[model samples]
Target: MTSTTPRYLRPGKGTKVANAFARGVTKLGISLWGSRVLGVRGRTSGQLREVPVNLLTHEGAQYLVAARGETQWVRNLRAAGEGQLRLGRRVEKFGYRELADDEKPAVLRAYLARWKFEVGVFFDGVDASSPDETLRRIAPGYPVFEIRTA
Candidate 1:
């Protein structure tokens, strides 16, 4: 298979609150471990929809891991293929390529290693030290994208 469709996990009340707080801080230009407000065009409405996301840098490349699985922003990103990562006055326009399941293991490892404390629960017990096979096993449930800033 080329890629697995990620399973969506709706954010709980606490997660929603935290995301909101993070977005607020990020809007003021304060990033929490690479946190940024992601904005994508709505597929149907053609209006901008925003969400808070962790931007991971691994092997000198950047990625966005859908730790909450195939969320609205993920779906939107797939359709729009480009969007912005915002931090207050700074707006970074970016393009993305969704990574296949086989390409996700390493990126997943790095992402888990960096933000596990915040996002671990959504990973279904997988940790940074998990073996390649283990990571691959869970890769399908999480979608990853390599991103480039312009």
Candidate 2:
């Protein structure tokens, strides 16, 4: 049987447009549904850039993950390594770390289920594997971050 390839497997004009649109939509969605405000200091210069991201609970603590590691905001968060989180009217600074391999899948599943429909449109041509694989391939570049108490 011929293997069904990922859309990124065939990069063309349509793929380019879809990818771009996905980024735009994701940014909008975060601004709307994301409940927490995050600020990342510029690693070298010490400037603060902030954005909203979906806050998640895993193992009874709060965390956030970049569905597509392509997000510049996530890059900024990484560069800073530590940041401030504001939920509702409260705020705190926290150290952040990328999650290990075994920790990623469950967090990914939670994220995809939270943002189901948008993911479908954004990640066109991905095979809907089990509910499990759907989450994994929903965003190949998924990167998870855990927040440490200040």
Candidate 3:
């Protein structure tokens, strides 16, 4: 079955609902089994946004990528550049930056290596060799960002 098809004992008309539910469950699983995630406050609206993103360590710097630019958490980060991330009982504020073309390949590679399975979504069709071109293509639309503890 394709990603669109939800796993089932058998296929039926409830596929859409099943697929949606499955996707939510999968996202929750990623958050739970993965590392801490942030709930950022919107700069203008004060809305709280959160997402399950990979926690990557590159050259001793901790990094998180905006794999999906459309995610609200990314938007909040872009607007404020600082927010809070919580894991278990700990929470801390962080400063974030949208990475430039030159800095993305290494981070992308690290992100890809850690969350190798979500490459298609994380990279958004980008690869190590052509990340610059991908960034250029996505520049006007979705771009990548990094976060640091504040």
Candidate 4:
């Protein structure tokens, strides 16, 4: 029997290796294409968990898109409602508001535009150049969150 997990949402071995590298390098004060160490408390354990994430800016707002669909950080962030973005020695704590599917296309487009080479695979065949209709159609599969700073 096949696993119920969607193919796009599953991180393969290479993705895992790359994420590990990104996390380690970013924590060491180096950023790869503006990657940040996202620290959010675990929903069940209450311990802070981190993964290097691409920080996207669009229309003067900061966003974090879950190109890999609903993963651990997405669940934890949803439960915690706030998290930290760390780059180098600096850490900024912020709250997040999950955007509706209708609100996701623009940010997702911007995110895809910037890091398509790295994350395009997760978006299936859609890309920054994809039509708005296509983006909206796939919007629900990708979760977009707006970062709110205090």
Quote each prediction's TM-score.
0.94, 0.63, 0.63, 0.93
Model 4, 53-97: lDDT tens digits are 999988999999988888899989999999999988989999988
* CA lDDT scores, all candidates in order: 0.91, 0.62, 0.59, 0.90
Worst 10 residues of 3 by lDDT: 2-11
Instruction: Please list the residue runs of candidate 4 whose C-alpha ends up more than 4 Å from where it truly belongs after superposition.
Output: 1-8
Where does candidate 1 have its weakest 10-residue lDDT segment? Answer: 1-10
Q: Which residue pairs collide, candidate 4?
A: none
For 19-124, candidate 1 gives per-residue lDDT tens digits of: 8999999999999999989999999999999998999989989899998888899889989989999988899999988899999999999999999999899988
Best candidate per TM-score, number? Answer: 1
Candidate 2, 1-150: lDDT as tens digits? 844542223335865675455434444443335456677876666888665566777667767876445465666777767888765446678887787756666776665566655444444544233455555544445667887886
Clashes of each: 0, 0, 0, 0
Candidate 4 lDDT trough over 10 residues, lowest sum: 2-11
TM-score of 4: 0.93
Error of 1 at 101 (Å): 0.8
Shift of residue 33 alpha carbon in model 1, Å: 1.1
Give the clashing pairs for model 1.
Answer: none
**How many clashes would you count in candidate 2?**
0
